[model samples]
Target: MAPDPPDDPYVLHARLLAADEAAFREVYEAYVPLVLGVATRVIRDRTAAEDVAQEVLSHLWERPLSYDPARGPLRAWLLVLAHHRAVDWVRREEKRRGLAAPHEAPRGDETADAATDGLVALRVRAVAAGLPDTLREPLLLAYYGGRTYRQVAAELGIPEGTAKTRLRTALRVMAAALAAEGITP
Candidate 1:
């Protein structure tokens, strides 16, 4: 393939903004490798990294306005986007693994502890199920979903402060309920 023109990124960006298909193709072919490399380095999983790279490229195509020429070159912007997406992927995987961790049987002779933990988890889930939806949503996202309060807020379309408040309220209600039921830790 011919090398990308040595034209200024601003010009290419303008072309992209104008919805020139050829310009977008050129940018995609030119920068995909670099973006993939950044994602692979951060994600450390080739398949997951490639997924992030594809998502970053798709986002660039769908939201060309997200890129600003004054910030830096297009290449740098693409690399940062790829890196952030890869990091987010890693965070989500970590959360999934963490949520499953408590359910896994212990590796050694801690069968008793594992059993106890399972019972506690069951009770917690039962308590959570009785919570109002507004309070339950944030609590599940933070505790079971392994997301931060900010993430819970973003996912639930609420302010971060509101997410925090709701999670706290849910926990307090659960605690009181558990105490009333004589379900002590």
Candidate 2:
């Protein structure tokens, strides 16, 4: 039979909670591939995905208490962290490329205009990322997913009124996030 996998994640987490370096290393080794895979799937850039994977692993080591077993399994938590980080990276990259939305190109010197556009786009994406899933799901479905609000409600299994509420709330939250990011939106 194949050798048994490493110790239980809870056991490993317990060791981690105790500030055991060895335990952190063990967890890192156990999950790095899975974490990297998740990050790459979302970021679609090997270098950025590696960076996000490292960030996720480092966060786990630095903040062991952040992982509460009650919420879910350790693996799931790690994957979630990886996914979020990857999304952040993708947003940042989108901002960098000024590809968050389409608009007329800046009229100034091309390089300077591109830089300004990038910053604005980045802020937009960062704020969008702050939106809660309740609102985000419907908004993404309606906007990026190219679905109508009705379709979004159907897909999310929420009443259309609830979906509309969520979409409005999400937009409000995104606007606030943008303001916080120092952009007028």
How many clashes would you count in candidate 1?
0
What's the lDDT for all of these models?
Answer: 0.72, 0.69
Give the TM-score of each candidate. 0.50, 0.52
Taking the tens digit of each residue's C-alpha lDDT, what string does model 2 give over 1-185?
12212767678778889998888877777788878877776766788889999999899888888775543456656765665556567666777898876543222234333443554555455556556777777888987899988999999998999988888888787776544323452
> What are the clashing pairs of model 1?
none
- Which lDDT tens digits does candidate 1 get at residues 1-185? 22444668789878888988888888888888877776776667789888998998888788888776654456655665665566567667766778435434322114323433454565577779879999999998899899999999999999999999999999899898655433454
Summed backbone clashes in each candidate are 0, 0
Q: Locate the minimum summed-lDDT window of 10 residues in model 2.
A: 104-113
Q: After superposition, how far is residue 57 of candidate 2 from its true place, in Å?
A: 0.3
